[model samples]
Target: MPTSSRSSEGGTRRAAAAALLTPGLLALGVSFVVPLVWLARMSLNRTVGPAELQPDVSLSSYVDVLTDGFMWEVAWHTLWLGVLVTVLAVAVSYPIALFLARTRSRLRGLLMALAIAPLLTSSVVRTFGWLILLSDDGIVNSALSTLGIIGEPLTLTNNVTGVVIALVEIMMPYAILAMIAGFGRVSKDLEDAAGSLGAGRLRCFVRITFPLSLPGVLTGALMVFVLTVSAFITPRLMGGGRVFVIATEIYDQATTTLDWPRASALAVLLLLLFGVFLVLYQRLFRMVEGR
Candidate 1:
């Protein structure tokens, strides 16, 4: 073929590739970008209902969200829950992940299956399990009664603590998968080398294994934190309508109160915070990866 003909065919292929990307890019913009933009616009809109003909876009939503003591309290509650869940899940999963990584038995699949089985259960189902167990006349109470650990049942449900317990159960599986991936990627040769150099098990783990697994732990923690932050069913069921987080607040504002502007504003606020966290995580990850 002539040089010009070959060049023309190459350019035609490039054009076709760009054309194929256009639809995907357009869909992404419509589904994600457009909604984000609309939420941002609504955040600035203060219209309450059909009464207002023209909604003025301003900083009122942000001002309202920031000034409200209730929202701040709710935000604090959510963050505390996220942090507690992340810490506890990491603590619990560390050993289990290590066990899974080290074990080579046929039953290892069964053990790993147990961790993943909870994930297969719906969020509602998992929370409901906690609800049944934590109730005054439930299995936990029965076991305690039978064991004489306590004379009476404990009040475990209808509180933030109850909600946290359920959240941890569901979130821990996700954290485990992340840790397993991380630990699996780590070369055991390093650990063996450290051990041969006179390091004890604890030292090898702390100095080599733990440091190398930091990326996994960090990513897993972040994933658990974000999921717990947005999770609504567990909190709604276990909190007994007494506790409110940002997600629950969004639900209440949009559904119960029929406040679109407020809901959108709250959503925008959440997205802003999420963006801040993502940026922070990226920077922190870079530092860790550099090490």
Candidate 2:
């Protein structure tokens, strides 16, 4: 072909690729970018009343959010809750994922089904189920009392502990699935070779299997952390309006107080904090990879 024809063909392909990507880009802008821009704008607006916000721009909302000791406490609670849920979900899912990855038995399918069964249910239903199970006079406390472990029912419901437990159940399936994918990518031959080199089962897993599975673990942890941090229904139900996270605070501001600017400000801050966490996580991953 002539050079001119070759150039024309390349241009055509580029145009085709751009055309294919245009719809997705437009959709993303409409669905995400526009809302984010609006939220940021609203955050800067001044709250004039319970039902009204003035269009005048100011940083008072953000200043209030940042300076208020209570808001800082809520932020800390949200961060720690996210971290705890991620850790618990990853820990509980790792062995299950390993089993699913290595097992060739018919039971593996049943086990996977069981793991994912909670996800098939509605979030409301799941949260209510947890409420039943964790209530002061509920099954957990009753069982403990029956076993003489406690003289009275413990305050498990409407607290951080209950929220963590519920969130863990909701997030565990995702963690397991991610880890299973990672574990599947690892070659069994590598593990066998480690064993042949006089490594015990635990040593082989630690040095060979676990390291190889880090990518999946990290991915799952990130997912769980984000979900936990953004969770509204589970925390609301499990915490019984007593445990206040950012999401709950946003809800109260938007609905109860009718302060759109304050709610928007909180939402923006939440996004910024998550953005910071993502950057730090990426840096940490890169450092681990470098080592």
Best by TM-score: 2
Q: Which candidate's lDDT is highest?
A: 2
Q: List the residue pairs that clash in candidate 1.
A: none
Give the CA lDDT, 0 to 100, for residue 285 in model 1.
72
What does the lDDT come to for candidate 2? 0.90
Model 1 is weakest, by summed lDDT over 10 consecutive residues, at 45-54
In candidate 2, the residue pairs with backbone N, CA or C atoms under 3 Å apart (3 or more residues apart, or in different chains) clash, namely: none
- Cα lDDT for residue 24, model 1? 97
Clashes of each: 0, 0
- Over 146-216, each residue of candidate 1 has an lDDT whose tens digit, in order, gives 99999978888999878988888888889999888867546778989999999999998888888888778
Tens digit of per-residue lDDT, candidate 2, span 1-291: 699999999999999999999999999999999999999999999987778888978998999889999999999999999999999999999888888888889898999899878789988899999999989889999999999999989998899999999999899988988778756546788988999999999998889888877877877888789989999999999998999999999999999999999999999999988899899778866664555
- Runs of candidate 1 with Cα error greater than 4 angstroms are 1-27, 48-54, 107-111
Local distance difference test scores for all models: 0.85, 0.90
Q: Can you give the lDDT of residue 289 in candidate 2?
A: 52
